[model samples]
Target: MGRNTRKRSTLANRAIVASAALILGGGGLVAVNFYASAGEGWSSGPRTQRAENAGQQVSTIDCPEVANELPREMPRQARGEVDRELAAIDSQITDAYKKFADQKEQIQRDPQLAENAILNPLKDKRQASIDRITNAIGRGGNKPQGMNNLAPCSLRDDGNDQGDGQNQGDNQDGNQDQGQDGGQDQGGNDQGQDNGGQDQGQDNGGQDGGQDNGGQAGNGPQDDDFVDIQSIEPNVDEPQEGNDASTGSFATDCGVNENGKFNPDNVIVAPGVANGAHHMHDYVGNQANDAFASDDDLANGDTTCQNQGDKSTYYWPVLRLQNGQNENDANADGGGNDQNVGEIQQPSEVTLNFVGNPVSKVTAMPRFLRIITGDAKAFTNGDANANASWSCTGFEDRQLKDKYPICPEGSQVVRSFKFQSCWDGQNIDSANHRTHVAFANEDGECGDGFQAIPQLVQRIVYDVPPGPGFAVDSFPEQLHKPITDHGDFINVFDDNVMDELVDCINNGQKCQ
Candidate 1:
C-alpha cells in the first residue's frame, strides 16, 4: 500500500466520474431534442409518419342513376322537339349569364345596376326562348302557363308576404318581426305571428317575455339575451388579393363527350352516398370512369383529352335550366319521375385548364388527387360556406356571391375554380380532403416545406336562360335550388404520364 496502489485507486475514481457525466448528459440531451422538435412546428408529429396513409390515391366515381332516366321518359317525338327548342333557349340563357357575371360586383353593389345591366336584357331573351318552346309544343299563348307559373324575377313577388305563420319567405331585411317574445308579428301582416306562436293573437304569457302587450311594446326578448354573436379572428395569412402568378400551364376540354354531350360520371355525394348527386355530370380523360370507377379503371381507360398519356379523369355536375316546373316540383318524386316534370338541358361547352407553380418546379403530382370545390349544401347554408367563384367569361374581375351569375349581353356565365397545388409530399388526401394539400401563396409559390404541383383551373360555362324559371335539379334535400350547384374532380393519371407532367412543370414548359 505504497505510491503505486494510491495511483491505481485515483485512476479508477476518475473513470467512474467521467462515465456518470456522460450518462446524465445523454438523458438531458434526449429530452431537449424532443421538446425542440415539437416546438419546430412538428407538433403534429413527423410529416411522413403523421401524413402516411392519411389519403387515398383513388376515389370512387358515381353519377346519379336518376339523371340518365329523365331524357328517356319523354315521348320520342316530344323529346326530340323539346330538346331542339330547349337548345335554342339555352343559347340565349348562356348569353344572359355571361353578361350578368361580368357585372356581378356592380350588380350586387347596386340593385339598379342588376336591373339595367342584367334583368332587362335577360328578360327579353328569356321570353323569346320560352315563346319558342311554347310554339314547339303547340301551346297558343304569348305567356304559356308553364312560363307564367315560373315568372321572371322582375315579374314575381319578393315572396316576403306571409299570409299565415305557415307561409313565409326569408327575412330579406334581416330584421325579425316584432311580437310577443320577439317572434312574428301579432297581426296577420307585418311579419306573421309572435314569440314562435303560429296564431295571430296568442299571448306571450311569461313564456319568453314577462307578458304580451298585444303585439306592441318592446320588440320582445332582445337578441343579446339568448344569442352570442362572436367576431371571427382574421387569419393573418389570408391573402388580401387574388394570386395571378403561374409558371407553366396546360388546358383540356374535359366536360363534354365526343358527341358534345354534357355527361359527367357521378362520384360522391355527402361522403358515403355514392351516386347520390341526383344530377348528370360530364366526364372526360378516362373512358372507364363511372360513379364507382377505380384508379386502375382510370389509368387503363382511353382518354378524351389532348394528352392521351395523361389519364386524369375530370368531371362536374351538369347545370340544368328548368323549363316549366318550380324547383320543388321538378325534384319532387324523383328527378326523372315524369316527362312533364322538367327539362334538363346541357351546356354548350366546358373547359378545364391546369396551371403550375410559379416558384419551385413541380415534382410529379401525387397520383389520384380528389378535390371538391363549392359546397352542394350552399343553398341552405349560404354562400359564406361555399368555396366557388362565379363570374363571367369576359369580366373575370367581378365575382358573384350567388351560385349562378346572370350575364349581360355578349357575355357568358362561367364557374371557375383553382384547386390547391402544394402537397405534403406524401398523402393524397387528409381527414378533411384538403389538409394533404394547400393553396399556393399569394405569389403562386408553394407553402414552406411543401412541394408544388400543377394547379387545377376548372372553368364551366353554362347558358341558363335568364328568368325565375331556371333552377338546377338537385337532391330532394337541396330542393333543386340553383345555389346548390357544385363541382367535383378526381385525378387518375398513369405513373408515366404523371412523371411527364412533373417534368413539364419543373421545366416550365406549357403542356396539353
Candidate 2:
C-alpha cells in the first residue's frame, strides 16, 4: 500500500458493517465476530447484550492514530513536544488496556462497562493529548485538522476469524492466499512428520497456565496463532531484475546482542521519553541506544559491530517463551509492568545483509538515518505498515505475516525483515518516520521521487523448542500477537564506510 492512508474515519461504519472492528496501523491482525472471515460481515444483536452474545470478547481498544493525522511538515522546535505528546497517548492506551484486560469479564457481562470504564476514560486522555499536539503544530506549521475524530476509540470484538485466526485487513481483497496449505511431500525434509511424539494438534491444553491466563504470557499468542510451517506453500518470489541491476550484497556481523543490551525505549519514534515502547527490545550494534541518546551521543558511543565504522543501531522486540517463568524485567517497565511476561529467548543467529536494488544503482544511506520495519501495534493497528516475515530455517520460502511459525523438530524458527530501500533523496527522516523511505514496487523500481539505496535485510533465528510455546514480546494491548513483530535500525556509518557499501552494491560485488 502507498503512504499517508490511515484507516480511521470509517471506524463506526466498519464496526457496524462488520460485527468485528477493523484495527488499523502496523501489522494488522483482525479478530472476527464470526463474520465471513475474509468477506461477509457479522450481524450483531443489541449493544446492551452480553459481550459474548453481542459479539465476542473485546479484542483491543481502537484509537485513531494521532500521528497519522499530523501535518507532514512541522516546525523542528515543536517536533519534540509533539513526539512526547504522541508517546503520552501510547502510555494512556497501555494503562487503559491494562484496565480493560483486568475487567474483561465484567465488561463481557455488562458491555457498557467497556464504554464507561475503558473507552470513555481513554477518549478523554487522548483528547487532551491531541489538543496539545494541535497547539504545538500551530506554533509553526498549519495546525492539523480532524484531530477531534482521533480521540473517540471503540472496542474491537474477537472471534476465531476465518475459524483459523487469519487477519483479513492487511490486503484490500480481504481474501489473502496466506500460503497455509496442509500439503507436504518434502521427502526427507518432512521433519514435522519425522518428529517423535510431539502432538501438533491445535488444542493440546498448552502449558500449565496457557490461554486460560489469556495470552502468550497471560495476554496472547493463542492456540490459533501458531501454524506449522510445513503446511504452508512456497510463496516468496524475489522481484525481477533489470539488465543493469546492481545485483550485489554486503554483510555486517553484529553478533546478536551477545552482551545482552536491552531496553524498552524507541529512540527514533519517542526520543527523550522513558519507556516509550512499553515493551522490551533486544539491541545490537550501537550500545548508546536509549530513550534519551542524542545524535552526538550515538556518534561517539561504542558499537557492538565488528566493523567499527558501522556504529548503526538495530533492535527489535524480544521473543519469549510462554511457559510459566519470569525474566529479570518481569516486574520492570516494558516487561511485566506492561503485561509482557515471558522468558526472553536469545537468537541463535543474526545476519544483517545489505542488498542492492535489482533495477538500479544503489546510493549511500545518509548518516543517522532511522528506519523502522514492521508495525509494533499490528494487533490493534491494521497491517498498513506491517512488514514481518516468519518462517523456519529450512522453509524460508514460505513466510507468514499473521501466524507464528511452529517449526519442525531440529529446525530453528526465523524472523526476518527486508527494510525499505527507496529514499526520497532529501530528508533522512519524515514526520511519520516512514514517508522519507519507500519500498520498491514489484518491478524493483523506486517510486517517482525516491532513489534506490542498499536494502537492509535482517534475519534472526532462534533455537527455541519446536512448538507454539514461544512468542515475541509486544505492547500489552497488542496481545503478544505475532503480527505485532517489528524491527528498527539507525544508520551511523562514517562517510568512508558508507561510500564503500554503495560501491559494493553498485559494482555488483559482495563485501563485508
Candidate 3:
C-alpha cells in the first residue's frame, strides 16, 4: 500500500470525532444501531418492518438522513461531558500514533540488516482503534459505563437508522420485481448458456475436438502428438527415505539445486548453537558495536526477560540498527492521532550496511503468512540475519565469519542431494547462499504434537548475469545444493520431489 493510503486510516478516526454530534440525535442513533448490531437475528422489541431491514449490511460512511434530525447544539452539561470523553479517546489514539511515527523515523535512519520482531503489537493496536471507532458509533443505546458519554453513541444510532432506510429501498425493489417475471426470465437466460446456444452443440457427446463440445484447441492431447512418446522412466535405484546422495567426486561447498518446498513439520532442530556471523551488516566497531552486542546477548540468553529486550536502546528492525532518543520519530506509536515526525538521522548506535546497500538490511517485515496455535505464533523467513543486532557482552572473544563455523554443540550438519538447475544468474553470488527452510517463534504455533513453535518457509533467489538476453526469467534450472539450519527438510510440497530432482540432475536434464 502507498504511504498516503496508509495515512488515510488515521484520518478516518478523526472524522468520527467531528461527526459525533450528528450521530447522537434520535434518528442518527437509530441509524448507527442498525449498522452496528453485534450479530445476525433480532429480538422481539418492535414489529416494525423497518427494524427487520435495518439488520442487513452496515456501512461506516455516509448518514445524510440522520444529519437532518440531529440537534444544532446539545445542552451545556451534555456538551461538556461529550468534549471530555472525546478528548480522552483522542489522547489515547494520539499516543499510539506517535510511537508508530517514531519507529518509522528510526527505521529510515538505521544501517544494520537484521529483521526485528518487535513493533508488531503496535500495528495491531492501530487497527483495533479503527474498529472501535466504528463500533462505538453503531451502538449508542445504554452506553457502556466508561465510554457512555462520548458522541460515538449518537453516531452509532445514525448507522442503525441508515440501515433501515436501505432495507426500505430493497423492499421497493423487491415489489417491482414481483410485478415483472419477464425481466427475471431474460436475466436467467443471460446467466446460463443453455438457452439459444443449444443449437450450436451436437447431440452426440463423443469427443471430436470440436469447440462446441467444451474441448478447445491447445487443451487436450493430440493423435499424432504421441507418435514418438514413450513411458516415463522407472526408478531402478531407490535409496531409503531421508538418505542423502553419495559423496561427490570433489569437495564442493556450494551449488544450486531444485527439490521440494520447505515444510516445518519435518524440521529436526538441534540444540542451540552459535553460527558464525556474516558481515551482513557493515562496520565492526564504532557506532554499530552496541547493536552487535545486543544480538550476542539474545543468542547467549543473558537477557532473561521474556518478550523483552535491551530497552535502553530502540532498535529499528528494518535496519537492524540502534536509534538514540532524538533520532526516533514520535508518531509511529501505532495510533493515528499523533503529529508526524519527519525524517530523522540514524542513531549513533546503528552503523552497519548489508552488501554496501543500506536498504538490504533484512528488517523483519510483518508476515503475510502466519500460523498461530493457542497463544503462540510462528513464521518463516528466507533472509535470516538481515535485522540482527549485537551487544558488547559477547564481542570481545567472538570471531566473526559467515555461515555456521563449527555447527554448535549437539547439532549435526547433515547433507542432502537432489537435482541441480541453475537458471537465471544462479551462480552470481555465493552459490551456497540458497534459502531452503526457516521456522520461527515470533508468533506461535509449534509443530503438531511438538511444543516447539513451528514456521516453515523456502524460496529461490538468483539473478541472471549481465548479457544481451540474460534475465532472471531467462535462467534455466540447474543442479545445486541449498542447506538451512532452520528446518530439516527444504522441500515440503512432496518428500519425493527431491528424488525426482536428483534423477533429473543425474540424467543431465537440468542444471549441473
Candidate 4:
C-alpha cells in the first residue's frame, strides 16, 4: 500500500480500537468527563460535528488564547503589533507540534537521536518566539496600566498530541506491558521497555515526539526518594547572621506593569526545569525563559526589572496567605480556589537585590551559575533541610514555623533567601546543580575547597492583605504547603557588568 494510504489505515484502526476500549472499559461516559475536565472546551459531539465546527476542533490544551483576548484587551494602536507577534508564536507552537507528530515514529525508535535532531532545535525556536513576544510587549510599555492582566503565553505539550496515530499504538503497548509486569519479578525486558518508553515519551513528547498514555508524569524533579519535611530539620545555618556587611548592593524595582497590574509572566515558576514550574513564580530580568533557556538567551532577552544591563535572571515562587477556609488554599485536593491564588494584588513594590560577597573580593562570577535557594521539593518529602524563611517585614526577627505566614495589617509579607555563592573553582554546575557551591560559614567564611564569589540575596516583600485567604499555588502533590516555595537564578550579566560587580565587591564600594 502507498505510505499515505497505510497511514490512513493505521489511524482508522487506532480509532476503532480506541472506541472498542472505551466501550469495554466503560470509559464512554468517562470520555465526556475527560472532555469537560480537559478545560479546552472539547466536546463529545459526533466526529463529523466536531470536524464541522473548526472552533471546536482546535485543541486548547497547550494553546495560548492570549492573542485572541489581546485584541479585546489592548488599545487599537497596540493591537496590531501584539496580535502579529502572538500569531507568529501560536503558529510556531502549532508547527513545532506538527513537526514532532510527523516524525513520531523515528523519534520513538531512537529517543536520543530525536533529542538532538528535533527536541533541542524546537526548544530554541520556542524560546526565541517567546523572546520576540516579550520584546514586543516591552516596547509597548513596562507597567500594566490599562492593560489586561493576562498570563504569559505558555507553550506546554503535556504528551497529549492528537495528530499522531502511532502514539496510540505506543500507549497500548505500554499499558499491556505494565499490566503483564503486574508487580511480578521479570527478566527486566518488559519493565525496561515500559520505563524507557515512558521516560522518552515524557522527556521528548513536547519537543520531538508524540503523546504517550494519558498525561505525562510531571515536569519537576522526581521526588520519589524525598522524605517528609517534618522528618528533616530545617537548615538553621542562617547565612545572614554575623555576615560581613555588604560592600555594595544593586536593586531593581519590579513592581507590577506600568498600569500597576501584576504580570503573571514576570514570575515564571520554573524557567529551565522540566514540565514547567509546578507552581507560579514571579520572574524578572530574563524575558525568554523556560527549562531550556541558555545564558545567551537570557543575555539577549529583555527584562521586566529595572537596570537593563543587569541581565541576571531572578525568580521565586509566589507566596499566598492561607485564611481559615480552603477557598484560596493551594491544597492537593483541588478543592480550593487556588487558580492564580498566588497572583497577589499588584504589589505596592517589588525589589530584587544582589549583594557583594562578604568574604571574597575581586573576581567575576562564572557565566550561567544556576543557583537555587530553598528546596522546591521541601515539606512533603521527609527530608527538609530547607533554608527558606518567611517573616513579616516589620517583624523580621519573628520567623514563622509554617511556610505561609499571616502578617499583621501594617506589615508586608516577606520571603528572604541567601544563595550559596562559594563555587568549587572548577565546575560551573554539579550533579545536584548545587553541590559545587557551598554556603559561607556563620563567621562569613567560605569552606575549604570552595572559592567565594559575590553573594546573591533575594528579598521579596509583598503588600499582602492580612487574612487567611492567601496561599501559594502549588503542584497538586505539594498539598498547598508553603515549604515548597523556592527561588532560582541564572547569572546572565554582560562581561562588563560582571567585571564591575567584581570590582565593586573587591573594592568594598557600595553601589545601586
Candidate 5:
C-alpha cells in the first residue's frame, strides 16, 4: 500500500507569542496550553467536514503517542529495552507511512485496501513492540494497561490542498484564526519590500523536480505553509517582573555549526539508536555527541563554546531551502531516505543567551540536565509543548507559531527558542524526555516543587533567499511543518562553570 499522502501542514498553534516576548516578558512561559485544545475537539469542525467530503484525501498517518503513556517512574532496568522497542515502533510507523504514501491513490479508491494491506499489518507490528515493552516494564510486577489503544493508527483526510491553505480556520482552531487572518492576511505584502534578497531562492538556478514538500524533502509545506512576516501583528507583551528577579543576563559564544557537526540521533529519547530523529540536526557546543554518547563522553567532549569550561551540547533541526538540491545526506537515513530533501542552509548567527528569572533567584542546573523545549511531533501530536517561534530580522516583534515567515528581500529568517527554566531539583532526565523540567509561569515563577534556573533563549538566524521557500527538517510523518521545529540541550558544564553561572545570575552579575 502506498503511504505517502500529502496532508495540510497541520493548522498548528495559532499566533503564538514570538521569542521577543520571552525577553520582553522577562522569561515568561510560552503559553503552550492555550493551543492544547486540539485533541479536545474544539478544532475538529473543519476536519470533520473535510473528512466527510466524498472527495477528501487521506494524507498522513495518525498514531497514538506511546511515550506520553509511560509510567512516570519506569523501572530503571527496563528503560533500555523500552527505548529500543519504542524506536522500533517508530520505525514500523515510518515504514507504513512510506508504503501508504506510495499507494495512496489505490488505497484511496478502495478504502478496504488500506485496512487490510496497511493498517492491520502496522497494528500487529506495533502491538508486538508494545508487548515487548510491557514485558520489559512488568518483568517483576504488573504491566501497564490499555497499551493496545496506542497500536490503532488512523488515516487523516486533509481535504484538498489545505482547503484554502494552512492558515485555514482549523490551524487557528477557534480563537486565533480570525485574529491571524484579520490582522495579517489582509495586511498587504507592503512589508515584504524585498531588498534584492529575492535571489536567495532563485540563486539555486531552478526549482525543477518537485522532490521537496513545497521547498522541503517530504510531503509538506505546501504553499499555505508560509505567510508574509510583515502581515503578522506585533503580539509580544512586556513581561512583568517581581522584586526578587534574578535580573542578570549572560551570553555563551557558541559559533554556528561552522565545524559541521551534524546528526539525526537523539540520545535523550532514543539512545543508542542511530538516526532516531529521522531528520538532520546541526550540532554546536559539544563535539562528542550521537545516539551512543553517554554522560561521561559528553563530559569529556570538546566544545565549540568559547568558554572551554562549558561543554554543554546544543542542537536543533537544520533548515533547508525547497529549491531542489541534494546534500551529502541526500540518500542517508535522516535525509532523502526519510523524505527530508532540499539544500541545507547554515545559520548566519547562533546566540546562546542565559537570562535571569523575573520572580526568583536562579540556581545551578544539575549536570547533564536534558531538556527539550518544543515538540518534534507537533504536526501530528498537537502544540501543547511547542515553544519555538519564527520571525525575520528587524521584524522580531512579530513571531509566527504555525506558519513560516516569508522574509522580504534582504530580511533573514529567524528561529527562536526559550528553553524551560524550571528544574525538579533532583533528576536530570525523565521517562518521556520531558516532565523533569518545566517552564516558568507567565509571572516568571517556578512551580511549588520546581526551582528557577537559567532560561536559555536560543536564537538562530538564516540568510536564506527571502521568501517562503525554506523549511526546517522534520520526520517524514511531520511533513517538514515549521511547528515540528525543535531544539535539544544537554548541560555538560563542569561544576566550576555551573557554580559560576549560578552565582552570576543570583548576584545579578552578567558573566560570560
Candidate 6:
C-alpha cells in the first residue's frame, strides 16, 4: 500500500517474469537442437556413416570373404543391354581410331608440327573415349533399367535368385555359412513361409517396354556379349614358358617386384569367389538393397539393388596406363633403388584372381585391370623419381612407419606378375584367394588408358630398384629378366616412362 512496498513488489514481479522467459527460451533452443541432430542422422544415415568411417584410422569391417565361384552369366536382357552399349562404345572408339590413324599417316608424311599437334588432339579424344567406356562398364553403365545403381538389397533377401526367378543354388559356402548363423540377418520372408493367405499371388507384370523384354535374368554373362580387348598387338607365338613365362597381359601394372612370389595371394588379378573380392559388388552393387511390397514382387522379377552405402565399390583404382615402348630397368644402374620408375603413375592395386574349373568367359583373361589408389599427387607429379603418395586416405594401412601402406618401408609389395589362360591350379584360380594381386602405382588415374602401361592381365609391384635386400649382382641379372628373377621389371619410373605415358595422354592409343 505504501510507495516503497509497491516499488519492491513491482521489481520482484519483473524479475520472476524475466526468469520464466529465460527458461522458456532455453527449453526451445534445446528442443530445436535435439530435432536438428536427429534429422541430420536420419537424413544421412548411410552416407555420413561411410564418410566418418573413411576418416577413421582403424578398419572394423572384416575383409570381404572371397567368392570362389565365377559370377553366373549376365541375364539375356542385361547382356543385350551391355551389347548395345558396347556397340555404341565401339563405334565411338572406332571413329577415334580412324582419326588416330589419319593423324599417324600425316605424321608419316609431314614429320613436323602437324604430327605433334594432330596426334595430341586425337589422343585426347581417344583417352576420353577409353575413360568413358571403362567407367561406364566398370560402374555398371548408366542405363536406367538394365543398369543397377550400386544399391544393396533390402531385408537382406537370402533368396539366391539373382534377377532370374530360378535359384542359383545358394551362392557360396561362405554366404551359406553366414546365412545359417544369421550373420546376414536378412529379415524377410523365409523359404517356404506359409502362403495360405489370398489364393491369388499378384502378378505385377514387367513395366511396359522394360529392357528385359521377356528374358529371364539368367545366371551370368550373356553368350554373345564380348568384353573388349585393347592393347598392343599381342604376340601369341612367344608364349610365356616356365615361371618366367608372361603372357604380357596385365590389366593393371603397379610395378615389378625384384623378389616377388608366384602365389596368387601374393599376385593381384581380377575377382574370384573364394577371397570375397568377387562378391564385393553384391554389397556394393547397383542393386545392393531395395524395397519390395510383397514376395511376389521379387519372384515376379526385379534387378537386385545393393543397400545404401558408399556405392563407389566397383571403381577400379585410378589406373596409370603404361607405355609398352619404354622398358628401362630402373635397377639397371649402380644397384641403388631406382626411384624414377612408375613414380608418376597412380593407384595402388588390389588382387583378384578367378581360376575356376569352368571359368566364366568373362574371366577368360582379365581385359581391364582396375587400379584404385588414393594418391592425390600421382596425377600432378612431373618427375618419376619423387615419392608418390599412393595412399588412399580411408583404405591405406597407415599404422606402418614408412608412410607407404600397401608395402613395407624397405621391402616393396612386388607381385610376380603372370597370366595363364590355362585352367591350371598352379596359376590363379577364381576359387583360390591366392591368385589376386596387389600393387601400387605412383598416380591416381590409371584407368584412363592415357598413361604408359607395363604388362597385361598381370600387375607387378616393385620396390625402388636395387630391390629391398639385394646384393650387387642382383641388379644386372634382375634387370635382364625382371619378370623372371622376380626382380624389378625394366620400365622407366623416370622421365622416359612418364614421357611415354604422357604420349598416351596426348595421343590416344587404341586397343590392338
Give the higher-lDDT candidate: 1 or 5. 5
Q: Which ten residues in a row have the lowest lDDT in candidate 1?
A: 10-19
In terms of lDDT, which candidate is stronger, 3 or 6?
A: 6
Q: How high is the CA lDDT of each candidate model?
A: 0.40, 0.69, 0.17, 0.41, 0.68, 0.20
**Every model's Cα RMSD, please?**
29.9, 11.2, 30.6, 20.2, 11.2, 29.7
| TM-score per model over all chains | 0.47, 0.81, 0.15, 0.48, 0.81, 0.18
Which structure among the candidates has the greatest TM-score? Answer: 2
Find the 10 residues in a row with the least total lDDT in model 3.
472-481
| Number of clashing pairs per prediction, in order | 24, 8, 92, 31, 23, 105
Model 1: per-residue lDDT, tens digit, 328-380? 22322223321112334445566776766654566667677776555454433
- Arranged by TM-score, best first: 2, 5, 4, 1, 6, 3
Model 5 TM: 0.81
Off by over 4 Å in 6: 1-78, 82-316, 319-410, 415-420, 423-457, 462-512
Q: After superposing candidate 2, which stretches have Cα over 4 Å from the reference?
A: 1-56, 160-216
Candidate 5 lDDT over 1-512, as tens digits, reads 01122321211223322111111022121211111121321122221122122332465777777887777678888999999988888888888888877766566667788899889999999999999988888995578888887888877655323223222011212121111221111100011111112223332221221233223333655434566777666877545878898878778998998887888788888999998888889999999999999999998899999999999999999887655456777767887778777677778899998988888899888889999877777666665556688888998888777667777677888898888888889889887877788876666767789898998889999877644457888877776767667899999888998888878887888889
Candidate closer to the true structure by lDDT (higher is better), 4 or 6: 4
lDDT of 1 at 446: 64
In terms of lDDT, the best-performing candidate is 2
Model 4 residue 200 distance off true place after TM-score fit, in angstroms: 44
Residue-by-residue lDDT tens digits, candidate 3, 1-512: 01211111110110001001112112222211111011211121211122332222111111111111123223333332333323233333323322322332232233121014223332344335434533443354322233222222111111132112321010111110101011000000011112111222323211111122321111111110110001111112222211221211111111121111111010011112111111011111112122123323323332211222211111111111001111122222210111111112112222111010011111111111111110000001111211111111112122111111111222212111111111112111110122111222212221222221111111112121111110000000000001011111111112233233334333324311
